[model samples]
Target: MNIFKKNNNLFYLIYFFLYLTLITGFIFDENPAGGGKKDYLLLQVHLIETGFTNGVMHYLFDFFPNGTLQHSPIYYIIIYYLKSIFSPDIIRLIIIHIFLIIPFYFYKSLKLINIGNKYICILIPIIFFISPNFRSVALWSGREILSLLFLIISIFNFIKFQKNKNTKNIYLSFFFLILGSYISPEIGIISIVYFYKLIRLINLRFFFKLFFFNLILSLPFLYYIIFFYSDNEFNNPLLVNLYKNLSSFFSSICIVTIPFIIFKDIKKYFLFILENKKLIIFILFISFFILNSPYNYEFGGGVIYRLLNLYGFEKIIFIFGFLGFLNLIFLIKEKLYYNLFVIIIFILHTSLNLHFFQKYIDLTYLFYFIFLFDSKKINDYFNNSILVKLFLTYNLIYYIANISYRIY
Candidate 1:
């Protein structure tokens, strides 16, 4: 009875931590404003005004077959409807982005895995929050995070359908995926993986029927692309830009791992790397030195292309990093090794992508809390040997110090 009660309490604590973290994140976003990448802020306001006054909201938000807008009309349309009712401030938009949508999807993902126990459940978002290069995604009131939230929610609902057997959740999941795809095509690709997972679980007849149905449902958005954006600014030149971006995405992951190259003694440092095949894949995916070469032209040109590519690579790093860390925790008997690897991965991943570093820094408190109560053998080692603690502490501090070098 005591064990069961303890388990229940842990579950409650996990949920409570999620709520607290999101509230803190929202509170921190008090002024929420950006100018360079978020010029869409003014564009959204213009669309709302055009809709209210000229009654041609669609045209104003449309592609215009020229170098007018880089994004799709769906996001603007949603804002237009929202502005129809309440005053649309950037803070409110940001609160909605970070607090409502992002955290909810994050909680749902953790809950789906059935690890809602306080210690394990909180690790999901806390890890992501402190991950490097995550600042831009967490704070920015843009289509990317919103679209990602929708995509993840769609996956959650689809997973929920397996147990509830509710047609509604599946339908809603499909709706969000279609909507998210219309907002961000990269999200569309990620959504396909969820759909595939769903198909693998359900019976065949239902799978094909719903699959083709959603595919058809999303086809209309292509009409806007075909008719409106065919001759737009994003043509062959944009295609070349995207190609260059693909190269940088590959290069960033490879180049960033170069620092560890000189540290050949990491074999003694990361037990997680030794035991997990998943960790091996992750290391390969994000280690920049693994992919970069002297003739790497992909790293030097096409800034916008590199920016887009970085989004996909960042997602890969986050998912794999989390997976790798979890596996390390289970296998490693040393607390120092786990803490050091976590710190190193966090620093290396974020240092190169300072623009999005907020995502990783937000979880610092959670990690510190975990480290305080760690049960690994390395904890005893640290307590018994002051020199070991000093050495590890110095390395961790150096990890943070080098992050400044990556900041351009």
Candidate 2:
């Protein structure tokens, strides 16, 4: 299993090269994605005319459209406070600060997966260069970027809790996650895994403790929503739609090879089952859960029939789809964070492509950090070298595409 044996040096060289490419792309990139130069100038003008608080409030509440209200007000206040106290030219400094936060995100992602390898940090800078959303984070301007920072902080604290098992870290994680949820819907993306884990681990005492913890911490948001928030559902400003939850499950079918495995290796797999007798029960258990899902037919129908109209090959799609679903269940059970993060990025790319969002793809780059943590679990296709190569190549193409899009 010497995965790095022959390619260690190449990996190291490419890793550093990727880091430089990512940084230079950001440093020289004037893509006007985030609060662009025009917006920055306008904010400064508004400040001079109306005074600081009014100007900031105008930008925060009155500036954006109906959909923009979903963004967490906490993010607006922080950005306003920083922009007001500092030079009017706050964009460059903000970009620099975001870049500096890269290391923290890198280290925290690895810790989340219990990966102690410090060298994995080398892969952090452009870790999410694969997802277009990440590229925009470097440019700065979107309040979603602030939400991303909160997301990372929450993830880091959760990982810290994983290692230390501290209840305090749990509270800290929830606190930041709450703050992030206000900033964007991205923070709530974590609830899928977070609540599942809590439900799995809950005991009578832990339940009460968590109940009190959530109640006390949720007061600020609850109070704010009731008193301060004027827009309905705060206009869901950050575009965190609950529908994105299904985005990952549906997108998992993108691995076409996994579905094909059913027909290709179906006969031999039975022999494999006999040899690994102990695993059959586990496999059956996962399969049971997969078939039991509410959207069982739709999940497979998309893959075999391509989601347009499910006419041909219904049974073939179902069997293969079931196998793919099983693998997803296995990943969820064993590699929770790794699988969940990939789904988050997949949904981010697939679900958030609004008409006005020119740079959401670039800004949503937080995906890379999580995707890289446990590289071994890249996909179920890793057993085949060609599929593995394809998976890697696919991700690299995304990275290159994002860099090209941002730089150009």
Count: clashes, candidate 1: 19
Q: Over the stretch 219-255, how does candidate 2's per-residue lDDT look in tens digits?
A: 8666765555544533333353323223233333424
- Candidate 1 per-residue C-alpha lDDT over 92-185 given as tens digits, one digit per residue, 9 for 90 to 100: 5553445345545655554553424433333344334323323323443455556656666776777687668898888888888787778765
Report the Cα RMSD per candidate.
Answer: 10.8, 9.2
Candidate 1's C-alpha runs over 4 A off are 1-42, 45-53, 57-65, 90-98, 115-117, 124-140, 162-168, 235-239, 251-408
lDDT of each: 0.46, 0.49
Task: For model 2, give the RMSD to the true fold.
Answer: 9.2
**In angstroms, how far off is 98's CA in candidate 2?**
3.1
* Candidate 1 lDDT for residue 9: 60
The local distance difference test score of model 1 is 0.46
